[model samples]
Target: MARLYHAPLSPFCRKVRLALAEKRIEVQLIEERYWEASPDFLRRNPAAKVPVLQLDGRTMAESSAICEYLDETRADPPLMPKDPTQRLEVRRLVGWFDDKFHSEVTSKLLYERVNKKVTGQGYPDSGNVKAGSKAIKYHLDYMHWLLDHRRWLAGDVMTLADFAAAAHLSSLDYTSDVDWNRSAVVKDWYAKIKSRPAFRSILADQVPGFRPPPHYTDLDF
Candidate 1:
């Protein structure tokens, strides 16, 4: 069995987890305090990041790279498109969520609200919090725009792009930072993804100091 060192709320880790679960690949989940940077952990990945995956006698780093490896190795329920143009769109949206959305929203909201406390980084910055709050609305609206024209974020079929967006949104949802009412289409899209079996573990996540909203695990919500 593969083993994954990950932070529960990390979108990157969650993206890999989703890809693994969607492929029916069982992996051991080990939570790591990467911020503390244990010598043994550092030896595993010099970059010192969560989602250091141990598979097939190899240790892998970087969430995107790991996910792509899993998708290519396990073809069932593919997370990427076969067509080159569609593949480009999938990668683009994946990058949008993993990089742009992460910098603009996840880092500001979930990182400030939850990661700070978990990593002992002092209190959340009110300015950053406000900015994150505002930024999320626009992001949600953008998602609504995309969903209005397509069945999924990248195309008609679900792909890694959907997982990438869901990963970030799920992390924000954990901290009650996402405003689900802002976009009905986006909310509907989330509802579809949230109802998947792969999302169960995520919805059940419980941080020692933080509690999820009551509806976090409710399928109907």
Candidate 2:
């Protein structure tokens, strides 16, 4: 069995967990306080990041790399497309969410509201929270635009791109930061993805000192 060191609400960790669960790979989920950077944890990931995955006799650090490695090795219920063009698009969208969306929205909102408190980093920054709240509207509009044309974020099929976006959105949704009513198409798309069995574990996650909204576990919501 594989083992994962993760923070319960970290989107990157959540993304990797989704991929593993989608592939039906049983894993041990060990919550790690990466901020503390203990010697054992640092040895697992020199970068001191959550989601250090121990699989196939190797320790993996980066979430994207770990997920891709799993997809390549498992090959069942693939998370990436066969076509190079489609794969490129998937990678693009993954980068969009993990990089752009993360910087603009997640780091501001989730990090402020939940992570800071959990890590003993003091109170949430109201300015960052406000900016994150405002920025999510634009991101939701972008998702709406994508879903309106493509069946999924990258193309006609669900790919790692969808997981990447969902990872961020789900984290935000946990904090009730997402306005589901902002776009019918986006909400519907999320509903479809949220209903997947892979999302079950994610929805079941409970963090101390932070409670999810009622709709967080509601698949129909």
Candidate 3:
């Protein structure tokens, strides 16, 4: 069995977890506080990041690389499209959520409201929180636009792109930061993805000192 060093709410970790679960790979979940920079954890990933995956007698870092590797090795229920163009689209959307959305929304909201508290950094910065709140509306609207024509974020098929987007949304959803009422299309897309069996572990996650909203685990929600 593989071992995964992860923090439950970290979007990057969640992305890797989802990919692994979707591939039906079993892994031992070892929660790591990367912020402390312990020697063992640092050796696994010198960058000191959550979601260091130990598999096939090798350690792997970076969620995208790990996920792509799993997709190639497992090859069943593929997470990435076969066509080059579609695959590029999937990668583009994955980057969009992990990088752009993370910087604009997650850093401002999750970092302020949850990460800071957990890391003992300080109280939530109201300005950053407010900015995240506002920025999410635009993202939600864009999702609505995408879903209006396509069945999934990148294209017709459910790909790594969906998991990437969901990974970020789930973190915000845990803290009750996402407004599901903002767009029915986006909400419907989320509901479909959230109901998948691969999402079970993510839905079951419990962060210390932080309680998820009641709707967090609701399949119909």
Candidate 4:
């Protein structure tokens, strides 16, 4: 069995968790408060980030790398496309979500709306929340454009890219930050992904103070 050190609501951690679950890889989830920068956690990852994984007798850091490692090591239900072109597209979208979307949306909205409260960091910043609200529209439009052409974000079949995007969107959804009405295509795409078995643990997650909307767990939504 694998052991995963992760923080609830972290898109990066969720991405790795989704990949692990999708592949039917059982993992022991250890919730970590990386914000505290504990020495033990620091030894596991000097950067002091969540989603530190203990697998195959080795410790792993970095969500994208851990996910890819799982995909390569596990044969069932492949999360990455085999073709070079499609692989490139998948990686691109993964980067887009984990980096650009994270910087523009997740960090601003989820962090403000949830993380600050959890960490006792004071109230949500109005300016950051406003910016995240505005930026998500553009990202939803981008997802709409992609889904209009392809069945999934990268290509015909579901890939790591889908998990990557879903990780961020789901975190935002937890705080009711995502506007499912912005694009019908995006909403439909999310509905399909959210209904999957891999999303069960995520849907069951309960943070200390915050609560997700009812629609957050509704598959039909």
Candidate 5:
């Protein structure tokens, strides 16, 4: 069995988890406080990242790379599209959520409201939280636009792009930060994805000192 060192709410780790679960890979989930940077953890990942995966007698760092490696190693139930153009589109949306959305929304909101408390950094920065709250509306609108045209974020099939987007959105959803009523299309897309068996662990996540909203695990919500 593989082993994963992860932080339950970290979007990157969550992305990898979703991909692994989608591939039906069984892994031992070990919660790690990457901020503390234990010697063993640092040895596993010099970067001190939460998602250090031990699999196939090798250690892997970075969520995107790990997901790709898994996708390559486990070809069945593919997470990436076969066509080059389609694959690029999937990668684009994955980067969009992991990099752009992460910087503009997740860093501001999750970092302020949750990470700070977890890391003992300080209280939530109201300005950053406000900015994140405002920025999410634009992202939600963008998602609505995408869903209006395609069955999924990147194309007609569910791909890694959806998991990447869901990883971030689910983290925010845990905090009740997402406005599900903002766009019915986006909400419907999320409801569909969230209903997947791969999302079970994500939905069951319990961050210390933080309680999820009742609707967090509600499939109908």
Candidate 6:
């Protein structure tokens, strides 16, 4: 079995967790307070990231790298496309969510709204929260545009791209930051992905000071 040091609400951690669960790999989940930057945790990941994975007799850092490694090693249910072009698209979308979307939305919202309280970082910055709330509308529109054409974010088949997007969205959803009514297509796409068996563990997650909205666990939601 693999061991993962992760923060439950971290989108990056969630992305890797989704990939691991989707591949049917059993893993031990150990929550890590990366913000604390303990010496032992620093030894695991010099960057002091929440997701440091121990698998196949090796330690892995970085969510994208870990997820791709899992996909390559366990090719039963493919998370990436076989075609190079399609794979590039998947990677691109993955970067979009993990980088652009994260900076614009996740960091501004989830980090302010939840991470601050959890890590004792002080009160949420109302300006950043307001910006994140505004920025998400644009992102939801973009997702709507993508879903209107492609069956999934990158293409017809669900891939790591979808997981990447879902990871961020799901984290935001946990805080009731996502406006599901922003786009019907985006909502439907989320509903489809949320219904997957791989999503069970994520849905079951319970944060100590936070209670998810009722619809957070509702598959039809």
Superposed on all Cα atoms, the candidates' RMSDs to the truth, in angstroms, are: 0.7, 0.7, 0.7, 0.8, 0.6, 0.7
Off by over 4 Å in 4: none
- Relative to the true structure, candidate 6 reaches a TM of 0.98
lDDT against the true structure, per candidate, is 0.92, 0.94, 0.94, 0.94, 0.96, 0.94
Off by over 4 Å in 6: none
Per-model TM-score, in order, reads 0.98, 0.99, 0.99, 0.98, 0.99, 0.98
| Model 6: worst 10 consecutive residues (lDDT sum) | 67-76
Among the numbered candidates, top lDDT falls to: 5
* Residues 1-221, model 6: lDDT tens digits: 88999999999999998999899989999999899999999999999997999999999999999989998899989999999999999999999999999999999999998999999999999999999999999999999999999999999999999999999999999999999988999999999999998999899888999999999999878
Tens-place lDDT per residue, model 1, 52-155, is 99998999999999999998998999999999999999999999998889999999999999999999999999999999999988889889999999999998
Across 1-221, the per-residue lDDT of candidate 4 in tens digits comes to 88999988999999998999999989999999999999999999999999999999999999999989998999789998889999999999999999999999999999998999998899999999999999999999999999998999999999999999999999999999988988999999999999999999999888989889999899998
For model 6 the local lDDT of residue 131 reads 98
lDDT of each residue in 9-42, candidate 2, tens digit only: 9999999999999999999999998999999998
The worst-scoring run of ten residues by lDDT in candidate 2 lies at: 41-50
In TM-score terms, candidate 3 sits at 0.99
Residue 103 lDDT in candidate 1:
92
